[model samples]
Target: MIIAVIDGMGGGIGAQIVSNLREELPTYIDIYALGTNSIATSSMMKSHANKGATGENAIITSVKKANIVVAPVSVVMPNSMMGEVTCGISTAVAECEALKVLLPIMPEDVEIVGLENKPLALLIKDCIKVIKKEFNIK
Candidate 1:
């Protein structure tokens, strides 16, 4: 299945998520990094996403192809620091057949949580475990 990880400018969160996802999911799962900017995309790319895309258009369009989407709690909002993402991204994410592994804060049924830094890693692992449980990976 195609899994996408989204982020903006800093990409720090995306980087960390990709790192953990790589170790947990391995090459069996196809992971894509959809960053709001080049910076975020590059950071995630370093962690070994199958491919990378950036900017508003790239971000929105890429999500359609993925079977799963991952993003920090931050990206859920409309007005990103880099620019505006409109409601389309959220709608696509909300409506997509792919399960989203969003982080920290989230809307009801969207799928998200807080993780990393000690217990943070544990939380992410649990989240991934849940993802694995729900889907047929490789």
Candidate 2:
């Protein structure tokens, strides 16, 4: 399966997800870190993503062909890093046949992690669990 991990700036969101997936996912699944910038991709790459891509166009192109798209909550909101998400990533999500899993964060305009009180990583872990079960990523 092709899993796309997207992020904006520091890649903390994508990096964290990538790191966990690397440690927990079976070796057969493919992980791609899709970043809005080089810094984002590089950081997630260091976190052990199998591959990385940066820039809005590259991110869009990569995500378009992905089977699953995992992004931080920020990726759904407008930000300076990727020059607003509506026309880029948002459009891709609207058009592509990819399954998206968004993490919980500030501002509240995007999707929440939806769980009992827990840390972000743990919430994300649960998110991955659902994704794995749904897709049978093992």
Candidate 3:
């Protein structure tokens, strides 16, 4: 299965997710890093994603082949990530056929009610759990 981990800005979140997945999932599962910028892509690549791509077009095309897409909720918000997320990028991610595993994290201006505020590490752990369940991994 292909899991696309999308992130922008410093790509730290994506990197952490990719690293955890690499350690937890089977080698056969491919992790693709889809970053809004080259720096983000590089960060995720360093964390051992099977492949990496940058920018809106790359993200738009890559999500098609992914079985799962994991990212912060902001990924679906246009103009999020300090304006790194474009309308096309957000639309593509939201409309993709893959199962989306989005963290509750969002920009300061947007507030999602009724969701517990968890630390980044805890959120990522939850992400891994969901992915493991989907893949039927122990």
Candidate 4:
């Protein structure tokens, strides 16, 4: 199965996700790192994503091939990530056929009601569980 991990800015979150997935998922599961900038992509690559791409067009194109997409909720919000995430990028991600697993990470000036304010590590672990369930990975 192919999974895409999308992120922006410094990509610390994506890096952690990639690292954890590398450890937990089977080697056959391909992880694609889609980043808003080169730095983010590089960070994820360091975490051992199978492949990576950067910028709007790259993200738009690569996300189409993924069976699942993992990203912060901000990835779908245009003008988020300090304006690194464009409308096209957001639209592409939202419109893609892949099942999306988004972290409830609130960006500046935005608030998501009813979600517990959990630590990022805990949230990432939950994301792994969702992936496991979706792929029926034991």
Would you estimate the TM-scores of all the predictions? 0.79, 0.84, 0.97, 0.98
- Please give, for residues 20-122, the per-residue lDDT of candidate 2 as tens digits: 9888888777899888778888999999888888777887798877888887556666553446454676667556788878766645443356545668788
lDDT of 3 by residue, 1-138 (tens): 899999999999999999998998899999999999999999999999999999999999999999999999999999999999999999999999999999998999999889998999999999999988887888
What is the C-alpha local distance difference test score of each model?
0.74, 0.77, 0.95, 0.95
Residue 134 Cα positional deviation in candidate 2, in Å, after optimal superposition: 0.4
Off by over 4 Å in 4: none
Q: How many backbone clashes does candidate 4 have?
A: 0
Tens digits of per-residue lDDT for model 4, 73-137: 99999999999999999999999999999999868899988899999999999999999998799
Clashing pairs in 2: none
Give one digit per residue, the lDDT tens place, for model 1 in 46-104. Answer: 98988999877787788888877888654656654445345666666666777777766
Evaluate model 3: give its lDDT: 0.95
Flag regions of model 2 displaced more than 4 Å.
Answer: 80-86, 108-117
The TM-score obtained by model 3 is 0.97
State the displacement of the C-alpha of residue 83, model 2, in Å, after optimal TM-score superposition.
4.5
Specify the highest-TM-score model's number.
Answer: 4
By TM-score: ranked, best first: 4, 3, 2, 1
Give the per-residue Cα lDDT of candidate 3 at 72.
95
Please report, as a residue range, the 10-residue window in candidate 3 with the lowest summed lDDT: 129-138
TM-score of model 1 (CA atoms)? 0.79
